[model samples]
Target chain A: MAVSNPFVLSTPSLLYALDLAGTFVFALSGGMAAVKHRLDLFGVLVLSFAAANTGGITRDLLIGAVPPGAVSDWHYLGVSVLAGLLTFRFPSRIREDWSPVLLFDAAGLALFAVTGAGKALAHGLNPVMATLLGMLTGIGGGMARDVLLSRVPAVLRADLYAVAALAGAAVVVGASALQLPAVPSALAGAGLCFGLRVLAMKHGWQLPVAAPADPPPGKD
Target chain B: MAVSNPFVLSTPSLLYALDLAGTFVFALSGGMAAVKHRLDLFGVLVLSFAAANTGGITRDLLIGAVPPGAVSDWHYLGVSVLAGLLTFRFPSRIREDWSPVLLFDAAGLALFAVTGAGKALAHGLNPVMATLLGMLTGIGGGMARDVLLSRVPAVLRADLYAVAALAGAAVVVGASALQLPAVPSALAGAGLCFGLRVLAMKHGWQLPVAAPADPPPGKD
Candidate 1:
């Protein structure tokens, strides 16, 4: 079982590095959100970890990979904590502009999407399920962060957020079907996802909302 | 591995029945919430499944149970759908009184807590972790439902909600430590949890909130 565990990634240090970078950036977003919400320092740290690791943890769990890498590896925790501490210490600096956070989030989403699909495929999921899993990985972290803050998940309402992830995941699956190399396929997928997200943000692209006859009541 | 799978529960027909019952009640709560939120039919069904199964799915994932029972078993889906449809069709009848929903929620929480701890123990988790997992299982569903509705999780602020679950889980772990039979131990755990929750609701018991000098900003 140990020999077959794809999460080990002993030879793919680059991919591991990208994963850590994604964790750090997502942690930054989570920490910033916590600060904005006036949560205490401990709460900020918890949000950071939840945002950084939830997607990977969920993917691993679904694929029968016990003790998710985010849990077993100290590096993920270290990166998330570092990002959280930075956000807590310099909230004004980080919160001054939303552009950086948005960019970082897009990058994290792209990385997670491709990586999630590859892992699912490695675990023998069909192409369709692998694609769906990839999108789930991309969106899972933000969804968890939003949920903790008691907000409707942005992915459900944001401009082409989930659609972009699905598109990116589809690219990876398509590449695999064509027998393309993993590195190139991943790069292409990430590029497309990042591009779509940034463009959607810039252009204010949005999915259609259900319009009811009367406005819904304010109370839950 | 098949023989070692603790979730099989070949002889525990009663537990399975109880689990499905818990699922049905929770789904009813979720569907009612969706109707209140003015979500459409699809939204109601989605909330039903999410509210009913999120706890068990999360517990299974953490314990390395791949393809969570909620995903693999048709009965769980069938029960959730039935509850959702019932609520959608008869919102006025089900939502007439809050008391019934609250009681059903407590029952679901109690059932989930003891069963979650029992499963964790069967999977060889330490007593402390198993107890924590039980509490997570009890609260996870409601938290997810509230999050989807863009409201603060009732469990986080509700009267003794998480505390009651933890107490029940602790009782189950204690019984296991004493080598008590599974059936009676589960019954005792559920009884204690249900009692504590109802008492808290009746008496308006609450955990202290952080008293910041300034109120937090309204928007996230």
Candidate 2:
């Protein structure tokens, strides 16, 4: 089998790359967040794993992939723990330098969106569902991470996060419909997502916040 | 063939009752928490649904049940939304009524623990895994609810919450091991769980907190 197509460099390898890269960056972000919250060492590791894998775990479950990959794959577990340990050891490396953190986070968000959509397609979901699942994969981790720290999910409150993921997912699903090679198509989607996220951060782009309404029942 | 077991006194009926009752109580708690947080209407409803069904959805996913029952079944959706809307409409009905909230919360916890274990057993998980899944089901909703509301999860900090659920699950699993009727075993387990939770609340029995530890890396 002379594999000339870049996509044929092994589908599993591409997926594995996406998963590990995303997991590492998200774990770092989660660990840093934990440090900011003054969590103990145990709390930091818990948050790291939760933030790194919650999205993939969620998507896999929704697609009927039992014993989610995170649970079954020792590699995912190892990467998450390593991220936590590194963050604990090198807290000063991340101090108020938000740009580097933002950049890596965007990379993770983009990669996960692409891989998530691809996985959903492989699992036989419709384009629309796959796209939505992809976006969920991108945003779910951060949501879990923030919630664990007792904060409103950043996805709901932050700038262009889910929207960017959606765009990336759409690209992946669209390319699949055109019969494009998987690796290149996924790379393009990831690039677009990462670019948009970075631009959004730089320009402070945000979805409009809902105006506060009157209190619901139980209050005067 | 005629069904002779007490467990068959309408299995679906018993399951439906447990599901609805648990959903209603948890939804109420979620709504009230939203009110406490002064979230707008959408926020309240979202929180209510998350509190009412996250646990079941989680368990179903882990067991390879795709499009979880909560997502596929409109009845569950309707009940959750109705609870949210009602809480919004009649907030006064809940004010100054801490005891009722506590009682209902305990009920939901107990029922969910039993049902969750039952589902896990049906899925062929080992007893230990089934028991853990049961505890996860009991606590998952409230943990999500508290996290969304930006509060520390009561399960981790509150009195005997997860422990009570575990005990209940153990009873149910034990009964199953002895080939007891499902209805009676479940009822016994739920009753024990509810009683233990109530006692814990009345006596302020809590899991011991971790001693305060020094900050992890990057601290002066």
Candidate 3:
């Protein structure tokens, strides 16, 4: 009997890279927002971790992933910590620009949303449920981050963030029907989501605000 | 035929009292915390709704109770809003000492825990999962509340809060098994939970602090 080569590590390595980059950008967004609010260093770090981890945590728990995703992984913690430190060191540079932050935030949302839907599908969730999970993964963390900062969630605001996530999930599900390769299809879906989100921000795309009398609930 | 339903109104009124008081007190706890944190009036109101409604929201959503518990009932919102306004008018006096806040918080936990357990059982969940849902309900709102305030969650700390919620849920389960009256059993559970929490806070009862060592993995 012969052992297989170590080349198989590439798949996990690629996934890990995507996960880390996604976590880092979201954490950076959180840290920068905290700086804008003039929160202390400790507050910035807390916000960063909360924003980077909360969505994945909620998704994992709801989907019955034991111990939850963040608690089960240290890579996420490291990524968030690095981002927090960098944001603190360069607060002025990071906080000055709004468009770039929105772009990076959109990228994080896309990657995480696809990752979430893919994870759920791995666990045998239906397409509808997987889509919901994807939306949650894209928005839950930023919502938690915003509530902690005493602001309305960006997802609830006029943005294409959730729309992009939804579109990505649609791509994955649609691709599955066509018997496309799952791995490459997943990447393409994620890329489409990222591109759409960035383009939306660039073009000032926004969801129509809800009627003021029907203010969205569920913060508590 | 004259429409006369005094018993329908009177008996339901009693059960309504339990939920109403619980909502108001929890709203007060949330509002006072917001004031202490120096949040604006809108902030206090937002926290009040979040803290007062989150446990019920979690319970309803998990049990597939559509429209959510609080959303279906205007009384819950009414009480929370009134409590927020009152706290705003008297922030200094309302949160003068931490005792009342802790007590009200404990009481709120007990109420939601029992409510969640009953709901799960009604929805035909197995006993163990019902207990778990009850626990989630009790702590979920406070977790949301604290996260919004940018603090490490109190439920994750050394206090007996989670324990109290467990006791309340257990009491409900035990009472159901013994065929005790629902109202009386609920009060007993609430009393037990509140007592345990008040005692723990007063005596500074805590889980033993673990000695620091090499931090986990990259934490060092």
Candidate 4:
């Protein structure tokens, strides 16, 4: 008996291309972070893979998809390795301006959010859960990279990072509810996410941080 | 037709007890870390759950188990929350002595390693992969906790943390190969792991750190 996997079925060529692009950009960010931290070559590669694939791998796992595409597919590995090598060889060129990396990271984040929600919906997950999963897929890679480097994940405290992903995912979920076409819905979701992230960066927008706490009660 | 899930079939009462013990102890450690970092109540609870269940959840996901026990079953959450509450209420009591926490942590590590390998084998994974999965399960929770707090995972650099788990898992695999009884094999594996961890702590043993790197070549 043949079991049907949604990943094997619904991955159109355009979506696949966008997935690879997202992987490449995320891997580049990981490689840049590794170089900034003065990690060795192997560490750079490891971070690249982790940052590029962790989110998707996590989403796959939650949905009962074993042997996640990042693990089983060679293209993901190849893209991650190529990006890592490029950043390692030309750190100064990439590091000269942080804006480009940030822009690409936003693009990667948007792509992941859209794809993740679509995948979750395909797997029969409810809209609320699918949106959350999509946001998770956007943030999970960067969180893993930061954790491996012993730093707090920027998504946990950054300006509208997760919020942007959630908004994008919600858009996709809403479009599906409205019986819209998948391709145009994805494009619109990605565009909204990318726009929100860039605008937040330009305007120095931020989430509210917790206020300092008063001293704890003595023996109460 | 009823499909047999390995998790539903093979979870003996004793193993279930051990799993809960591991979760509680790990959760305590997480709560202690949160208290030390001055995290709020909700933060403590989140860290506790993340540290207690990440290893098991990851293991189940890899083995094609959806809705991991950590998420599906209520016992794990209840135990984690109980431990977190206790630690939060009596922070000084638990934090005053580090040795107790270390000892419990070792016990939890051993339990997780043994169980992880057994579950992998039950799912028909090869011995080598099962052993490695066991080590990952043993270390994954602590790694998650440390990462959330922005610290390097102790397993990656500490004295024989992963090594002890691997050794324990290897013993389990070896015993199975020799057709030894499952109970004895589990006991032996857990004992070996616990003993090694304690000894390493007592002797202040450490893994070797990478040496400082030389200056990079100019535009090579």
Candidate 5:
């Protein structure tokens, strides 16, 4: 049986480009996080790779893609390493403004969510699970990065992080179920996710926090 | 093709018993962590499930066991949930002393390391990867639990945690390579891991901390 090499040189296309772009931004974020924590060079690279590849690696693992895509492909590894090095060398450049980071993160989230859902569907998972897995793929890397840094995961607290991913994943799954064209469905899904995230950030939209023990604000 | 049900009612043998026992103890520890963090009931249960099943789930995913052993097996889920509820209700009882929790965690680590290595070898992984996976299985649950709580993972810093797991896994993988009897090999591996962990605790053994930018101790 011939093995499929998804990241081979011959597969130069938009989707692959999007995937690498997402990975680069995520790696930059991870490296920035390491800088925030004052981690050494080794730790910076470790965090960068973890942040860049964890989502895809996790999605692949769950879907039974052995030797996970991130581990198997040298290009993915090269991209992550380069991103880490660049972030380390120009920490101030990346950290000067939080807006760029948020924008990049949103883009990565949208792209990864769509691809994650698409892969899950292709792997024979039920639609609901595929959608959830897609959201997981979008959020998993950030979660892992935060946890390793001993910080609360942004997805569990931030405005519209997972919501955007889920919305994007839903569009992909829904479109696939309805037999829509692949490229258009993917673009639509990614666009919705990105737009919603940017809007949420601009408007300060947030999911309600759990306050199981606290009395109603004024009633107490 | 016939799918194997490893956790069926009829399969209530030693391995099954060990797995359940490990899950229960890990769940208890997770619940304890949640209580310490003052998380709500829902959070406690979520932590419990993550702590109990993450090791096996991670191992299964890496080896291409789709749906994962944790997700597919009802017994494991039930045990983890029950343990969580019990821990939440009796938090005071479990918190009065730390000795029992440590002991239980050590036992779970030992058992999981052996089982993880065995499973990886069974799935035809190379010996080195199999051993590493075994260590990952032993420590993965605790790492997940700590990370979710926004704390540094104990395995990364605690006395001989990952070391003991790796040692146990090496024994299992080595013995298997040499065609040792399964039962005796497993027993030996688990015994070594548990004994090493207990000794490390008693002797206050720890991995050295990094102080990259600091001057030499004498200069300081």
Candidate 6:
């Protein structure tokens, strides 16, 4: 987005909101995974941390963001811990259905993608690298989550996960280049990505690739 | 290490040793984690995928490796499946020993660091970046391991986990530049790292960062 405001990224409260909400949702997803895996109370939080915050932490480390996400602020810790505890306290009672799980996960994914891309842009990464880093931040936690749970990655099988986050980041860069307002452009970019993902899920949409039976894969 | 034998990089025997050893050690660690978590048959293999090979897969993906690690090699799949089966059959038995687990994990860390740095060097990554990536590839699997186990990271906590890997990679690169024999230098690098790590563990050597005391009742 345009830099006219000069403080959009620097807003402390906004960062806190993103971190808290993101951590909460991520932690919840992690805890839920533990339920699926039939793990113990300790297992729930371990899965939560793996699922929720690793992406941003990985991104921060890669981009040379000193102290990284978990270390820079305690709010992320607070949210992750709370979500994990709640999930531990009431796994089945809290989330009676899978839809809420997916929705909250999607929201966290979208939020992290946009926020990650924002950080990448702030650091002046190449556009291609920026888009990739954003996608990585979005799905990295889930990948970690799935791996820990022994599930195939959600992105690999049949989801528009990475592309959604990539598109969101792409539009933000595109809009910022054209001098759009920071908040509106970010919202628009994030909204576009989120809307596409929701619609994809609603309609069971997915990317087309060669059949798995065929051994050969597509170009990188 | 010298360009005098560029063909050695793709030599069948060398590559085979690298692949088999890497897969074996990673699988051992993965299986161990599965036992710790008490996952079912499927869960054991699933965690193995995450713990054993995901680090190499991620490393490949980030470095623009085509087909990634999981898809490009059937050997990877074979190793994962075999490890999973082995884990399921002997979880109770395997869970008995600590020294064996650490030995396998340590060996895996050293091997992957060497190979990961070699790949990075092939891709012409700078020494600093290659060293960092080598460490990441070495520790990434373990980090995934610890996260799934729900503990503060072993590497992050103290000792020479990632640092040893970094040192190994650095030595490999330096040895290459000096026209040292690749096999001996590689072994030396690996030995230096693994030996130092063992020493660190035996001697209780680690850097300590002080934590803040809890605030009084009026504060957080």
Best by TM-score: 1
lDDT of 2: 0.81
**Tens digits of per-residue lDDT for model 2, B1-220:** 1222334233657867897889989898887777566665656666788898999999987776676777556577678889888877776656657688889889999998988887777777788998899888889999888777666686886788999999998887787777788888889999999999999999999898678697654513
Over 4 Å off in model 3, which ranges? Answer: A1-175, A180-220, B1-15, B177-179, B208-211, B214-220
Candidate 5 colliding pairs? none
Once fitted onto the true fold, the runs of candidate 5 whose alpha carbons sit more than 4 angstroms away are A1-14, A40-43, A212-220, B1-49, B61-67, B71-140, B152-220
TM-score of 1: 0.62
RMSD of each: 7.0, 7.8, 12.6, 7.7, 8.0, 13.0
Candidate 6, B50-162: lDDT as tens digits? 77777777666556565666677777778877877877777765657777777777787777787777666665555555665677678777767666665445564456566
lDDT per residue for candidate 3 within B132-182, as digits (tens), equals 567767777777788788765666444667777778888866776676667
Model 1: runs farther than 4 Å from truth? Answer: A1-11, B1-49, B62-64, B70-143, B150-220
What digit string (tens of lDDT, one per residue) describes model 4 on residues B1-220?
Answer: 1322334224467667878998999898887776666665655765787788899899988886675777556688789989988877777765458789888889889998988887777777788998999888889999988879877676886787888899898887777767677777888999999999999998987878767698755632
Residue lDDT tens for model 2, A1-220: 1222334234868888888999999888888889878899999898889988999998888777768889999788899999999888888877858678888889999989998888777776667777877988888899899877767876654677888898999998888878788888889999999999999998998764323354443311
Docking quality band of candidate 4, CAPRI definitions: incorrect
Candidate of highest DockQ: 1
Off by over 4 Å in 4: A1-11, A214-220, B1-49, B67-143, B152-220
What is the C-alpha lDDT profile of model 1 across B1-220, one tens digit per residue?
1232333233267567778988998898988787777666656766887899899899988887776777556688789989988887777765458799889999998988888887777777888998999998888988888879888788877689999999999998888888666677788998999999999999998999888788778763
Per-residue C-alpha lDDT of model 1 across residues A1-220, encoded as one tens digit per residue: 2232333233366568768888998899999999999999999999999998899898888777778889898899999999999999999966579899999999999888888777777666667767877887888898889888877777755677877888888888888778777677778998999999999999998764433334566854
Q: Rank the candidates by DockQ, best first.
A: 1, 2, 4, 5, 3, 6
In order, what DockQ does each candidate have?
Answer: 0.21, 0.17, 0.04, 0.16, 0.15, 0.04
Instruction: Provide TM-scores for the models.
Output: 0.62, 0.60, 0.55, 0.61, 0.62, 0.54
Compose the digit string of candidate 5's lDDT tens values, residues B1-220: 1222222122236556777887888888887776566555655766787888898898887787676766545677678879878877777765468788888888989988988887777777888998999999889999988778776687886788999999999998888778766677778999999999999999999989886796656511
lDDT per residue for candidate 6 within A1-220, as digits (tens), equals: 2333243365545645765677789889887766555554545665677688888878876886644556435566567768877776666553457888888887887777777777777776766777788778888888887766555677786678788888887876666556565677667767877887888889888899775786665532
Which consecutive 10 residues in model 6 chain A have the weakest lDDT in total?
Answer: A1-10
For residue A211, give model 1's deviation from the true position in Å.
Answer: 3.5
Clash pairs, model 4 backbone: none
